[model samples]
Target: MACLGFNPAKIRNQNLHYSKPSSKIVPSSKPIKIKPSPSQFSFKLHCLKSNSVSEAPLSPTEPQISEQEEEVDDPASELSFLDPEIDPESITEWELDFCSRPILDIRGKKVWELVVCDSTLSLQYTKFFPNNVINSITLNNAIASISDDLGVPLPEKIRYFRSQMQTIITKASKELGIKPIPSKRERYETVYQRHPGFQKGAKPFLTLDNPFPMDLPDNLFGEKWAFVQLPFSAVQEEVATLKRTFTFGASFDVELLGIEIDDKTLIPGLAVATSRAKPLAAWMNGLEVCSIEADTARGCLYLSVGISTRYIYATYKKTPTTTGEAEAWEAAKKACGGLHFLAIQEDLDSDDCVGFWLLLDLPPPPV
Candidate 1:
């Protein structure tokens, strides 16, 4: 699922009102905004299945929104809570920037990236990291299945497959910022997400759940597609990227607060602690992986700076002193790509402690 990237700092202060009685209204010359309760409105989060034929799914060939004109303005718009492709009925403003941003035509492939920007800090990019992967075990399993189907020896195919995997790993490692290819070591680091306290030891995950090069009837080159698997260390692997990592038991909230550098001006900043009564979900790219009170999903550790950039850097100075401190600041690189900032928040009780790296994207200091 894509994150709702509408800048939290821009959310009207009056709209942040929650759990108060109606009589607390403060009259103003400006519009008196009343926040809607969840009981009163629903922002359609997809429909449940029904037996009715009218609720059937659309066929793949069915006419989808034309790429040229993604969203047609609904002439019947009530209040004009306007967005090019956003549903006006959505109580929460959805970021439909992708629908309007120019699509990239790369190698004739229409690459539509989920880009995010904090214009105040001049930081922009999407989290591009590997989540789904077919590892060595999965590759071996695929080879075994394919060889049996094709009446070939698995040994010869394994050698050929290993070579292919090595090639892919070499290229990908450069893009992944893994010093040596993970293909070489049974243990190599990639951005990851997991709870802090699990039984300490190597824990193998995603171990050959489904073999790639699936045995389809028309798939003639199953071996061609099932070339190799990248085996990750089946270890405790407790480390995870702070982009999606959060304090284990702390209930928290996140807000993108525009900071005040002077008496008159405010700059972009993000905060992820206090004023919120409960745990909050962390949004990275389009994925919703962490919650203040719970873990909804996992494996959303990516936070790359650009399309060409690899390696989402979230390593720290120390293992969190307390489990409540999910992130630690070991060192701060002066610059990342064109972005320059300090590790302004870390340790427990800081805004970044709850998983929002708000101050990390600040503009460079005047030289």
Candidate 2:
């Protein structure tokens, strides 16, 4: 008996031949036909369906978007956005002069303009006291006339004319003697009756024996004593200086006129009726005649040269009497000099009354 040896190469060749021949062989009989169920077909279709819907056609949506866009682009809508930027409060008082002045329309545009000889004068003071501030008024009448031609308002135009007239009068008053007068009123009867040796009929009631002084709490009284008197030639210079400082030449054309000077004898010991009485008397004796009647008529001058006569008098504490008040009225008359004295009345029944008096400068004669 003999053992058989395995042939590895022969076995490998046989396995290769079997694998190759089976892969190449074709089936002899026809394949059986099969059909899928409807459920299975539906499931396959669902899996293949698109995730997102297709957009609608352009015609329907485009017109709506365009109409909405046009509304937002309207001109009126644009104007509404700009309204808040132009607020009136942003304008200042000085700028109001442009509004008050005559408006000029050229090339369909509006503007306010002025011309002045002395620009400095134009820079100060408004047509009204505090409110209507002008940048600078023109001194030249021609320029002002030009402004008028441009349809500027009358009030604004006249302010310049009046200011110039005032300057001239103020200058003339300096050449002549004139002054501002104190305007305080007080009563004399009670004060005089209280005094010793006060006679009902005596000459010069405003003499040293009787004096009207300020009657106010010391704290409220101003340090400068206010006196009532006729202004001297030098007074105009002082007024000009004052105009430069306080009012800025606003009321320069004002004057005092219609002055009537008189001297009367009264009870010598009677207390001076008004705080202004003594100073008024002094002013009457010192008045200078106005050189130019035209200038004098402007009412540019104050009724009296009101100065601080005495600090002590300004701070006096005694209550005023009726006679004392009458005396004060007389003093105002004297201070007014050329101007007639109107009746004096207490403004209020308080210490403040002693400090306030309304002395009107003579009005301009009817034109």
Candidate No. with top TM-score: 2
Q: Candidate 2, residues 1-367: lDDT per residue as tens digits?
A: 0101111111111121111111111111222222221110111111111111111223654444454443333111111011123332321111111121111122222222221211112111111111122233332332234225433221221212122234432333233332212211101232222222223443331121112223332322121221122222222333454445442111122221112222221101011123453343233223221110111122111222222221122112222322233244334333433222111112111111111112333322111
Residue-wise C-alpha lDDT for candidate 1, range 1-367, written one tens digit per residue: 0111111111112122122221211111222122222111111211122221111234698676442222121111101111224322232111111111111122222222122222121222221112233343433333234325423232210111122235443343334332221110000111011111112243332121111211212211011000000001100011133323542321111112211121111111122223331222222212211111101122111222211122211221221221112211101111111111111122213323232222222221110
The lDDT for every candidate, in the order shown, is 0.20, 0.22
Pick out the ten consecutive residues of candidate 1 with the lowest summed lDDT: 221-230
Q: Cα deviation in Å at residue 120, candidate 2?
A: 18
Using Cα atoms with residue i matched to residue i, what is each candidate's TM-score against the true structure? 0.16, 0.20
Candidate 2, residue 215: lDDT = 34
Best-fitting candidate, scored by lDDT = 2
Model 1 deviation from native, Cα RMSD in Å: 24.5
Residue 63 alpha-carbon offset, candidate 1, angstroms: 52
Provide the lowest-lDDT 10-residue window in model 2. 1-10
Q: How well does candidate 2 match the true structure in TM-score terms? A: 0.20
